[model samples]
Target: MKLTRIAQLGAVAAVAALTLTACAANEGGSTAPTSSESQAAALSGNLVGQGASSQQVAIQAWTAAFNQTNPDAVVEYDPAGSGTGRESFLAGAVNFAGSDRAFKVDEIAKGGFGACAADSGIVEIPAYVSPIAIIFNVPGVKSLNLDAATVSGIFAGTITKWNDPAIAADNKDATLPDLAINPVHRSDKSGTTANFTDYLSANAKDVWTWGSVEEWPAGVVGEAAEKTSGVVEAVKAGEGSIGYADSSQAAGIASVKVKVGSEFVEHSPEGAAIALDASKIEDGRTDGDLAFAIDRTTTASGAYPVFLVSYLIGCEQYKDENVAALTKAFFQTAVSEEGQSSAAKNAGSAPISDDLRTQSLAAIDLIK
Candidate 1:
């Protein structure tokens, strides 16, 4: 996995008006002559997408850029959690779905993508990337270094105190008080939950016996919050509180340095991109599906394993050409360099590498 220096690929601040002036500038949608030209020729329609609150910021940027070019287009994207988005898609209630986790094999086998033909295929494209940062609000502590076991144990309810020996062992030099440790978790079904739990389940199996499931383990010990905002607020409102969220939301909180390989690594766009680069396409997918199976157990020196490859999923063939054309156009735009830069600017996300973006555009072409 090759990584571009985060310094060189820094994100630009995403603004609707600015994106509009860029001609409303730029999608796979890359093979086209140009984004402006292609988007200008798009048909007028309304598209509604639901899912993946994690991608909400990126979606805002993408839609802003999209609407700038296709003025007739109306897009309403609900920041519902991934599960709800998938349910809405499968139920035929939404035009498309934004998800952190792609459709499972069994789900694809059900042949239930609502907008497509009975036996049509589906397409999954990875459009957004970010590190899952563990944020904290402990008084007097500006930073923390933690291993998988200690973190898992804390959320698992095995470690209750902020100054537990396990935690202190990882940070022997830091001053720690004997205050109670409060771990905040998402109450809604979330892709972020799935990634965080997957990491714990992969590295701290003994302590995280509940395994990796989207919703926090039933009855798990932690303050339950509704979404990213709720989780962030919950952590901020309490002392000795720790919560995990996309690094884009790391406005005023201290973040954790997680154990990765032999060294504790701080989250960065380059690190997150390395982990994403290490991912492999999931097996048993149709020829056109672009879903990835991220390996959260990676021990690469700079790769942050706890990461998400958010996706925009749609039918291989929509029943309506207008829907199909609009979906294809928007997806193409979202996967383009400008679209990715917008997301990075707005979400503190790492832009997809050119190789992955090229592959994604090729896959986008399959969205007939």
Candidate 2:
């Protein structure tokens, strides 16, 4: 799928207006009571964030929406990969970070101001939800069904042809081509890579051989691109090319449906929501650290098990009160019903369930 190029001028202007309005709202206070008051109270300054190219669509929506209401604040997010985002956040180069995966236990152990809070630890809330679409660009085939093994085999360079029996068996009705299958992968250490590898490891462990890792595993390899955009572009330019990316980013590409169990399911916001709803929160974390143990192998009828839950990581407290306020406001808006819905529309991502939304708001409260 190709990434849409919307003009940034209008988006930037809209965001600027939002920043001003948010600052005024924070200063003047509102007589009207609303469910998002806490979020409003935390609005006031500029914020810098970086991470997750997979969440680019959702993040752009979020920034644009937040700017509409908080016109006085500025929030800039760089769509770097997950690894770079984590590194920047840990180094305190950014006020917050967007990541597709949660921080490792070792990262938590490293004491840092942003990593640690006054009373609680840092907050990692799953805010954006979208399926990792298995996108393809093949001339003759418009649709295909790929099981976990076939997917792993293709990316691992084991299955090299478009007419492999395994692939043909899944798409018997369609005309199969004998073209060489060129699989694309992420060159950087990315959470998207982690999610994809995790699915392979969990479902096709025996054949895959490699376990999930942040950096791509050594044995299984393919042509690698730097970011989600790079992978999308590569797939678009090459015939018989296949790659996995966030569903929203696959705008003009043909995505393959995967057989989750007995059903062949296409990636969708509703389907991603089903998988997220089936997940449970991770245990043994502090109050401020809101991590989840996502069950990616869920076989629920409508759920796409390969969905990605992009997290918003923030410090519990900021040295600058204005920065704290801005962070809180941004987070509150992100977890709000309106905000989540906006994201759904602009990014093709699912909003968090009410149960998770309630918990997420409570976690944002700790950001002060």
Candidate 3:
């Protein structure tokens, strides 16, 4: 798969940062290592990861926390889009990957993760969970109530006006302007798009006929932006504009209250966690793989159906032992209580539950 120029540039930056970190670790030390660094310094190497712009803030927090104990171990992550990140991992361009989605059963069956030894299993942990907010910018509307059908219709280019009857019916309290609605989508292949499209496919199939996809479907016309930030920026710049992004990145923008059952539910970290708890693991996966099959059609009260379960993906066994060790340590730190709290505080993402954390650590332990 061909990476975009931005992704290519990010890859270069990741390598450069790794080189710089290694150089710093090897510098003639007049200064002593800090307590956090010297406590049990078993790890000392660079771990480069790529993928998922949505997890950028969380990744920042995770790397920071991981560096505290393993100061000699550098973790450099690039916020490339998910598809590019997965491709990089499969090509062995990066030590591990952070993706908004896990490798599918079919893809794993093909068995070509270059970082891993032949016949080795992979570890995929749901490390980040966040609601996908339906954000919009309208002249007078601070927020609007929308069902799956209305949301799908608006994005599918069927609902072109801000004052459409479908939208008006959902929000009787607001004065929606008569402006034309501009729907924006990710120009790059994105896990956010996949999750949003999956929700529409599961809940509004009649209107969203394109099915679940990472790329914007061909001929489904809309304004296209490069990443989550791009989509958010597009929506902010245009009047009566609508887009979807991880809730952590949707601050300062008006969002939709999606109808869960009889009541409309606003997106929240707690609500995302509830929806995730209602989801089941994908069947027939290896012990280390924990890919979730989210139930986007769920009508459970207080559950936000639209959410992304981003994963930290690595091999159960790697071609390089040092790579395996760094991946294990970093993954352990990411799923730890302190790590989750850091992410929650920094990114507004939902922390994985204790049961999930236990499972994640168990999977990470398999790395060697």
Give the TM-score of each candidate.
0.91, 0.89, 0.89
Which of candidates 2 and 3 is the stronger one according to lDDT? 3
Number of the top lDDT candidate: 3
* lDDT of model 2 at position 201: 81
Off by over 4 Å in 3: 1-40
- Kindly give the stretch of ten consecutive residues in candidate 3 with the minimal lDDT sum: 2-11
| Steric clash count of candidate 3 | 0
Indicate which candidate wins on TM-score: 1
Residue-level lDDT tens digits of model 2 in 1-368: 12222224235643554456556767998644224453434354668888898877666666677665665667777787888888888877888888989886677766574533443368888898888989998887777898989988998888999999999998989787899998898989899888888888888887777788768766565678889989999999999899989887888788888887799898899988888888887887777677778786889898888878889998887766777677877787787776677677767889998888888888888876
Worst 10 residues of 1 by lDDT: 1-10
lDDT of predicted model 2? 0.78
Ranking by lDDT: 3, 1, 2
- Model 1 error, position 321 (Å): 0.9
Which candidate, 1 or 3, would have the higher lDDT against the true structure? 3
Candidate 2 lDDT trough over 10 residues, lowest sum: 1-10
